[model samples]
Target: MPRADRFLSIRRDPLSDEVLARGGDPEAHSLLQRTGFVPVARAHETYHRVPTNLAERDEARLATEAVGRLRSAGYHVDCEGDFDTDHRPVHYLPLGASVAHIAERIREATTTDEVADALTDLTAAHDGVLAAVDEVLVALADFHEGLGDTADPHIARRLRYLAEERLGVITSDLSHTRNALADRHAPHPGRSTCTEQVPSNERERSAVCACPPPPRTLPAPPPPPVAAAMRR
Candidate 1:
């Protein structure tokens, strides 16, 4: 397994007697060896827009609960869906972003200072959530951007970097992202072949990038009105 630098390693099985002594499983022990687990709560696989049937009620409740927990923990979760793909009818992004919730806060805020306070709260929630759990950074990035339009320079730069530069959210379908990257950047001045694909948990994995970090995320704003509302 790669070194556990930033993220903690989840072990299915205990490796040492001391671990087993502490009630860690010894048999069937295996580490989640993906040294690079992406912040994947918002992955297309785990989400559903709104569970509709009674059988799904618990899952729906859990989903909302998860969102609440993530918000409390400091992740900036956002909802996204595509017309295609039943798997991702809706999912949360728990990362840095620049739209929707933040924008709405800006609009609803009574004063310019209020906007600043609101953004601070939103970002605090984001960073706090990511302190232990990094999986929700994707959608959370944009929650305060007002349902999708934000003025955060961080979000703006990331969006510009991806939409225009063609980075992140790369395709997993037959490795199209790799191919496209290779075609565009492989021959660039002093750049290597585009062989390194951005993993799904794209941001944290970039800490070791040979180049500067790609704009998968920017810092988030805050959430003061939210705190005030809660205090009431």
Candidate 2:
């Protein structure tokens, strides 16, 4: 038989065969069964070919696994079938970091400097999410334009609604957080600590008393709104 044919002909041994091979060792047989191990042909067959349909299915399974990982790491992804020339679906994931944790950190901040640092970090994270949103939107718009009437009219409409309604609300919340922080840190005029008085030891002599200004207390910033839907 040709090498490929021989490979294709090779099959796994039956469970009964496995049990008979380990006849005296019931524990070992049980172990094998428990592990679901299937005995395969020992002959090396390098030309074995998998059916194209099976290969495509495995590719799709792997892509789905990859997208799951990306989402776990805080990304926004959209995947659909027939995205590539080879008919393999492509993922349209965007790069964005979660800001929910940042909000919690800001809430836990004890000092003004800590709060300021948290605000800065939150700003950066928000910007990153916004940039990712913009990229996805632009890409979708271009795709829609390219397809014109050939594209499903509802597809673009739904995407636009998500981008505007969902993402817009997130951006607005971020702006509110920024404004609250800015207001908390804004400086205000206060009474001075310097005073002048006549010296008791020398009636004609005048002395200036310079007292250190009391520490200014900053009002606590309003809690940042939680973005449960925008976890990624």
lDDT of 2 by residue, 49-147 (tens): 212334545544444443344334333334444211232223333222255566676666654445555666544554654656756886796577657
Q: What is the alpha-carbon lDDT of model 2 when measured against the actual structure?
A: 0.45
The TM-score of candidate 2 is: 0.34
Number of clashing residue pairs, candidate 2: 0
TM-score of each: 0.16, 0.34
Off by over 4 Å in 1: 1-99, 125-232
Clashes of 1: 49
Task: Name the weakest run of 10 consecutive residues (lDDT summed) in model 2.
Answer: 3-12
- Taking every candidate in turn, the Cα RMSD to the unseen true structure, in Å, is 26.3, 22.8
Output the worst ten-in-a-row residue range by lDDT, candidate 1. 19-28
What's the TM for model 1?
0.16
Q: Top lDDT: which candidate number?
A: 2
